[model samples]
Target chain A: MRNPLTEAFGIEYPIFAFSHCRDVVAAVTNAGGMGVLGALAFSPEELEQELTWIDEHVGGRPYGVDVVMPVKTLDRDAGIDDVSDIGAQLRSHISQDHWDYTDRILTEHGVDVAARDDGLEEGAGLGAGVLGWTAATGAPQIDIALSHDIALLASALGPPPKAAIDQAHEQGVKVAALIGRVEQAQRDVALGVDIIIAQGYEAGGHTGEVASMVLVPDVVDAVDVPVLAAGGIGGGRQMAAAMALGAAGVWTGSIWLTVAENGSSPVVTEKLLGATSTDTVRSRAYTGKPARQLRTAWTDAWEAPDSPGTLPMPLQFILNSYASQKMGATPPRELVGMPVGQIVSRMDQVRSTKQVVVDMVQEYVDVTERLTADLEG
Target chain B: MRNPLTEAFGIEYPIFAFSHCRDVVAAVTNAGGMGVLGALAFSPEELEQELTWIDEHVGGRPYGVDVVMPVKTLDRDAGIDDVSDIGAQLRSHISQDHWDYTDRILTEHGVDVAARDDGLEEGAGLGAGVLGWTAATGAPQIDIALSHDIALLASALGPPPKAAIDQAHEQGVKVAALIGRVEQAQRDVALGVDIIIAQGYEAGGHTGEVASMVLVPDVVDAVDVPVLAAGGIGGGRQMAAAMALGAAGVWTGSIWLTVAENGSSPVVTEKLLGATSTDTVRSRAYTGKPARQLRTAWTDAWEAPDSPGTLPMPLQFILNSYASQKMGATPPRELVGMPVGQIVSRMDQVRSTKQVVVDMVQEYVDVTERLTADLEG
Candidate 1:
């Protein structure tokens, strides 16, 4: 478990957990692996509350925060001065055809399209569509994260703005960026990123086309920073595979969604638990860019020939915000899906985050030992 | 190095090389790693000739032959009695719209589409479409292969038919099948497959949706047979990663294409050498099934909006057979691409097959030792 990353982060193991649930983040941090809280769905105030809770619960252990600052967004030049108004501004860009198609899909699925309220609170559990996706929204989250006792700050998409990287470095917080390509890794390294999380195609949320087995080592060979292998990595065998591919640590996202301490809706949790690796698809139906998520009727509707295509980043999520809320309120079993990697097949149990960490470490040790024995014999 | 696969195959290392070149196959076998020649492109007589050459070259070393016995093919029920006539019979099924679109694409690319002749010898270097794809074409190749001293017989597309499996077993030849899904692995094992090659999404040629990091372990857990990890594996580090993920050996394809002994055209070899991992795409342009190949003009033309969508298996290949020969003859640099994996980026040098095997073994040892040191400390 001892590596450059483990020593630098002062963690017992090199397992990095990414979760949107603050409880899961705190539990992983308390269990010796560093848990990173995803800040994409949270407002500045909500993020403050979550980080404060994590800081209090970790008992001085180090934890991190992950923010979504997409390099390219439809609202980047929309001239929306107020971050609160950005969501509304982006919603206006959604085409009427897209809306009509989306509604038709829900209607066909027997979902009540009119059930969603016009208030922000209705979209709470389904994720805030335009929140923290642009600089205007993400800057405040970064400011709040740096103000806290965070050990690392990760950007989920593209390289973090240089100014923000400098600000994080000034605050003694290490900056990490998730990249799916070797060119992106080089660009991130040039921008002074302290770590590179090479997320592969089999990962949840946004991912590149390359898989972890190839992407991890490619990024490792292309950059000088410690590379954390993300995507399709769930348990100890995968963790060992990442290490074998020249990764300093393993960055896992989907495995945390089904943990006992997490608060994922029962429907989504059950789907994830029952899914095989083939149950996921890399589609642009949810986000504007391709992301690996559980294949659902919702995704299928977007992929149908007659359906209107997805809109670009801030706009697509904005269009999805309402349907997401409706689905959250009364989940259609076939339409309720969350972001998950190919590793969903391995997450069959609802163990505590601490137990998951223990099992992964145990399995990693057993695999490495077996491999070592092969060399000796 | 000393896994069950190595002991069973009597190879010095657990490296399995897949190539269409007989020279590359024999060279790999002589280097102590078993080589499996792709039999999809050859007639029974050609395969016999190739196998006889390999037998004389390898000094009685163990090697294998790979045939494409697709469980479902367009000609499965075509009622074509003669294997030689199967190609022409299936070619008639190609629609006029597809032919015009193909010609338009070639013409747009400065290629003279009418230059392609109607002779069978013209399609020699480019893969023979409708050849060895169905049982009519493959059964004879299997017979020729069994007549030789082949150590193993592998099915590249589907599980070899039960009769073929029985015949191979009766001849004391072990059977292997390449699968992208865990369910496929289970099905192959039930049908008496001796070895399972869990080919991942990042692999060259036809592959499934799952990547090797996840698919290998999933298949390993589902089946009792030894598994060979394929896709996105080119070097020793990748070999180590496959081993860490519980694969008994490494099955490599794209790496062999760039080796000095391979007979790939200079244009394709140069393009492959210069390609990054992202330079390839899992496209259905060349083969109707999704296969990972270089992102070339040929693939792009087939994917264009105005282009008629590709046809199913044998028909699509048959449609491209003329264009393939033309491209091979004129050497359209952009259109002369071949099947390749994401690891094409790693094939920067033109090393001999023997050197490639030695380098892989050395790197595997180095990586395992480094991991062993991590455990020891």
Candidate 2:
């Protein structure tokens, strides 16, 4: 599809795939769609190494970098110079009562909260660097990302700061912000975002209650820039729906979670494949904000009446860091969960990212052709 | 626009406008889109009169009947012979404390519970013939509707009972059922439903949590029958989105609430027109199930912790019946509300139903052409 998205990003298809795994990124980029790597998961050094590997493997195709620099995140307005200052502030805010409650819930669920030594040894316990919640840390990541050749920069929660936007624009990297509400879309556009990813409530992580059908057209109407539709978009039909709602393209995340190159744990992959759409819930247990995820024992426990409430944003991430590492590495790994959209029900098997793109484009073409015939006749 | 929905219903556009008022149904049907009158709001005799008025005014255009024959309702399996029997059973189940709480909340909000004499005089209080909820009630409505010249019949909560389906089919009227989940789509298909209304969470009235972007494709894939996408479809962009998701047509409800031909009160229409997507909530306070409605004092009061919890289905309706009539017709009318989709945010003015249909078709044509050009390029 040769929409503005394809032309702006210089890709063959308008499908922009987001994944944490470099393998999926390289595969998608090489397959003619833009592959956006979730760079918040990697440190500066690790990100450099991963980018070098991708540059070597991608054959000079266009791809993007996704960073988590929420405008209203914890310590966002602290005017901090260093990531360490923000980390210290974040740690100080999480009460001991919340920590004790986490311990109680994890222990009750037979999760090995006691095996947190490995996390501390690996410096996983909250300190200078945690999940990319602070702009202080995210700015460095952006600097690292700009140090490389990338096509787009996508901010998940809100519009990236002026410095980040300007820096990306300097490198010819078009900037995008994902928004759940029309007001956010208007703000993002006014802030000079090149693209607005209008994600509906059905999306995987950090979603609002507005569904895509309503949210997409609202965002499209509110913004001057081209929009990319996200949330519950996995196939060609959904991509076409996005276009019908006046979006230039589709920004996909959950569909990549089970791709053969995604490199998620086999247990997690199997659970996702077997899960139905009803098996998911919007829970704040993981990220301290409402995110659609696989309903698991871990999420269910946090929702119970006896359990303590979750902390907000960075505090919740800080508290979750210690136990999250253990849960992934533990035996059985029953409580292991990740953010996924309602489209997980459709991801019944593992396929190459290339095949996924090919199938989607083909189906999108056929469906559109049929619709055109219906319209004309 | 010339899909199976058009062919099956003998309409020009594949847009099915649903409203309780005869004026809207007649106006929409005369304007080339099929207008399905919501028959649940009227008794058999009243519905006959409404249908006769529509038939006289609609310029020989086709229309349909929407009966709320939810397979499982409050008194579904009681083998109830009449609405009185069901209403009596429903009243018996509602505790006196609950009634007192309802009375207290309404009076405190300046709603006159004693001013419902007009409703009693007009036969608005529950008795022999109420809105469609049971086979006993819906069957008679179906019989009356079949005696007319409707082109389609639809059930809301579940598959129409075998008798209803058979009766509709016998008259060559196609049968449809609205579904919120993929499982419900399959069940409806198995019951030989001709069309499936795959409504998403953004829809007004009783809806499930699944949004249209996910639910539409899931339902379209699960069933072999033609699917009509509903929920948040107030304009052409959303209708285009539905078609892209493999829906044969678009079933709309909320957009009609503010139409010039709709008979809703000016206060409720003003609230709907001024509201945003966030102003509505899926609360059990209204229909004893999660129904999206305008968040007025009535719904807010029932949701408050100090307020008594809502009784299930018919009980809640029975309890609210007295106060709701007063709240609508009395002086203040502050607590007046109605079912509306998230697209209620976009319904900023009152337009004639003909303009709505004409605008939708034109927009649909322009969008499909743009998408086709994009795909071809």
Against the true structure, candidate 1 has what lDDT? 0.86
Candidate 1 lDDT over A197-258, as tens digits, reads 99988898998899888889889998998999999899999998999999999999999988
Stretch of 10 with least lDDT, candidate 2 chain B: B121-130
What tens digits encode model 1's per-residue C-alpha lDDT throughout B296-351? Answer: 88899888878789988777876667676655466567777788999998989899
Relative to the unseen true structure, what is the C-alpha lDDT of residue B148 in candidate 2, on a scale of 0 to 100? Answer: 88
Residue B148 local lDDT, model 1: 96
DockQ of each model against the real complex? Answer: 0.79, 0.76
Q: What share of the reference contacts survives in each candidate?
A: 0.76, 0.79
TM-score value, chain A, candidate 2: 0.94
Location of the lowest summed lDDT over 10 successive residues in candidate 2 chain A:
A120-129
On residues B1-377, what C-alpha lDDT tens digit does candidate 2 reach at each position? 67666876678998898888888888888889889998887878998998888778877779998888666666765556665545565566668888788778778888777866674434433632235665667777778888888988987877777877887888888998998999988887888888999999999998998999999989888889999999989888888889999888999999999988787777787788899998888887776778898888878888886877887665676666756665655535556778788999889989999999998989888888888999889
Query: In model 2, which runs have C-alpha deviations exceeding 4 angstroms?
Result: A76-82, A85-92, A95-97, A112-130, A325-328, A331-334, B77-82, B85-88, B100-104, B112-131, B134-136, B326-328, B331-334
Q: What is the DockQ (computed on Cα atoms) for candidate 1?
A: 0.79
Residue A27, candidate 1: alpha-carbon lDDT? 88
